[model samples]
Target: MTTVGFLYPGHFAEDEFPRMEVILDTTIRLVVNRTEPGEDDRRPDTLRTLGEPERLAAGVEELRRAGVESVVWASTGGSFVYGWEGAHGQTTALARAAGLPASSASLGFVQAVRALGAARVAVAATYPEEIARLFSEFLAAAGIDVVATHSGGVTTAAEAAAWGPDRLKELAVAADRPEADAVLLPDTALHTTAHICDLEELLAKPVLTANQVTVFEALRLARRRTWAPQLGTLFAAREAPPAPVGWRPAGE
Candidate 1:
């Protein structure tokens, strides 16, 4: 049985687990850590504390012991710190530590944009407006143009996890731009994957979210071909799986 392990904060969208289970066919096991909200722990905040790499590395080791075949960082902000190289290096490090393949939300977002052939995109974020700037730079490095952005200023990881899917769709529609060919919701905690097909129908374009891309990217790395309408266009497209035994780290 192939296994995918997700490392994340204490809370997350209730919708994500069900979606993952159906898409991955009961191959997913969610492993969680503390929320670790710092001084700015509020209901509507986006300031995320960078989790210690040492702590994350240890967590990956535990997942490996549980027979996980691949691991994914389920938090967007936590994995975006090292920029492109940082994101790649961190996943490689975790893969080495766990003796399994690995990936992250941010790096996966880049791949999804490319898979969709999206040149200019509008991003809807669950983070504060300030954090949106960081993602814009990260996407630029990946050769994606940020045509527009909107932030909901969600403060805590718990709150982001608790946010309703209907509300998130509203944010995505509000954040979309007429000029963009695609829309991205860049927070794993926001639970936007299950709504991707709906969003596409509404906006008439590709819709991507962190968790959806994260899973797709990992499956690609593992040479697994997955197609799920609920997960959106990235998965809907048919492409050759990544070469086995030489999975380049994410963002490479």
Candidate 2:
């Protein structure tokens, strides 16, 4: 049986994992870590705490013992807020620690968009304008052109996770632009797997969300071909997966 290991924050919406496993038809083994919301731990910079060497290695070791085929650093903000190069370093550290292939939800959005053969994209984030811009910058560094964006100004990861279809649909529509081949909602805290297909229909464009792409990116790193027509085009196509993020010791 193929299995994917995920390292997530204690505050992420846990209910979605079981459903994502059911929808994607893969086993998801998770290692939940504490996200210390400093005086304002809920803020984006706090995400950097999760990538600290010792903390991340511990989670990766747990998945190694369980024998997950791949590891995914499943926090979008945690890595993206670190910038593109920083996100790469985090996933690389995870792969080396797990001694297997690896990826992250933040980087997963980049892979998912390209795998669908899309170069132009739109972003609908639950963050404030500044935080949302960070996600946009992360994507741009990957050579993806962001045609439009919508920020919900939702302050904390917990609040972002609780949003329902009404908010998600509104964001998707607002972010959709004529030039975009796809729309991306870039917050891992949001529960998005179940609603991906419906939103794609509503926007008339491929919709890739934090949770959906995270799973697929791990599967791709495992070199697994998965086609969840319900989840959107990212799953069904057999395109070349992104190069697995390689391990680099800090300051190397």
| Per-residue lDDT of candidate 1, residues 14-129 (tens digit) | 35755576665454444433334344343213332454456567677557666666777766777775677777887888778777888888888887777766778998887777
> Model 2 Cα displacement at 190 (Å)?
0.6
lDDT of each: 0.69, 0.75
Local error of candidate 1 at residue 18 (angstroms): 4.2
Runs with alpha carbons beyond 4 Å of true place in candidate 2: 26-44, 238-252
Q: Global lDDT for candidate 1?
A: 0.69
Residue 106 of candidate 1: its Cα lDDT?
87
The C-alpha stretches of model 1 lying farther than 4 A from their native spots are 25-49, 240-252
- Write out the backbone clash pairs for model 1: 44-155, 45-154, 45-155
lDDT of 1 at 102: 82
